[model samples]
Target: MRVVTMLHVEGELDQSRHAAIEHAVARAAGEVAGLRRSHLGRHYPGTVGGGQYTWDVLFDGRDPAALRQAPALLELVEEGALRLDTVAFERQHLSVPEPGIRDCVKRTLLLRVLPDTPPEAVERFERDMLGMPRYIDAIRNWAFSRADPELHPTPWTHVWEQEYRELRGLQEDYMLSPYHWGLVDGWYDPESPQRIVDTNLAHVYCPAATTILGWEA
Candidate 1:
């Protein structure tokens, strides 16, 4: 299973708190029961809403309780040192199959489709979103999944994740493509009748050395 936990430092993080928090988070991750790999870092400059840092973790199984009981993590939140949002989903429908694992930039979009949306419209939204990679070649590998609301309690309904060889692949090719701005973007554009996504969405990316999209199983 793959889970993404994003955080924003709530206030000034002096050097001392910074070191302690970093160490605490590292220790917590190592102790989590099903943890396989952990990627924690500030997002690349080009993206938005991904918070200050993203803790993208992979697990052998879904152990929600164990993740919550992560040692010393609650104290940081209590101390007003960090703000967090997390979503976990493992059943991925690949829009673009991965080439292979290598050093790359990992990006994720966590969005919400309003509960009142009719079923047919939601289906169309999903289809249009999946269609994006067909025209934007920079999206080397991609998966889009609907998150289970029971697991996270966050309103987010879907997760869109992908990897690019470099930032320019996303910044220039993907962002600048006609399919993005002209075609698939309507689902996210508030002014458009096709919009299904909540305006408050997370667009975050970070440097990754291994494939976080999970090709193994």
Candidate 2:
């Protein structure tokens, strides 16, 4: 089981405080039970969502109740360093080729399931999306879950996360995968005129160096 927490920070960044914040987060990660790895970072240039920073924490496996009152986390909130925008599902992995996914290139999608869309359609979309890893060999990891907009400062209702070996694989292999174009594209295509999802808020991010087993030092 993998629990990912994405923290969207508010206010301007003080570059000097970055180290302090990260150190604090590391301390929190260590103190929290079931937390195996943690990564904190800001969006890359041109990334869609405007969050100044993101904290991706991977827990080994824990009940929601235990995670909710994590002491180090509460301390950060109490200290005013972070805000709660969205706390989506602790992702249940469907296809993970390996355990060291922290080093993979990651893409996070903030999905908006339309009001008029039928529940069955949403279910089918999720079913198809999860099936991608089976068809696209380049997709090393994939997970997603429904989101609660009220829990987030943003308007999205679903979050899609994926991992790949390289940027080119995201383009040449996964994008070109038959499962994507044949089944998934129509649900998001604007020209179709009845798109079920609003994809404007999605973005890609790589884990920072401080994250356990992340690509950086």
On lDDT, the candidate that comes out on top is: 1
Question: Model 1 — TM-score against the truth?
Answer: 0.90
- Residues 1-217, candidate 1: write the lDDT tens digits: 7677888777666778667767877988887887888877667776677667788777775665466468668777777777778887766687436656588888888999987999999999888888888888889888888886666666789999888988888889988999899877888899999887889889988888867675433
Q: Which residue ranges in model 2 land beyond 4 Å of their true spot?
A: 11-14, 31-36, 50-52, 58-81, 90-93, 100-102, 147-156, 176-182, 208-217
Clashing pairs in 1: none
User: For residues 143-198, could you state the per-residue lDDT of candidate 2 as single tens digits?
Assistant: 66676433333466777776677666676897798788888887898777546887
RMSD of 1: 2.1
- Candidate 1 Cα errors over 4 Å, as ranges: 13-19, 95-101, 215-217
* Residue-level error in angstroms, candidate 1, position 23: 2.4
lDDT for each candidate structure = 0.79, 0.62
Give the Å error, residue 208, model 1.
0.8
Error of 1 at 46 (Å): 4.0
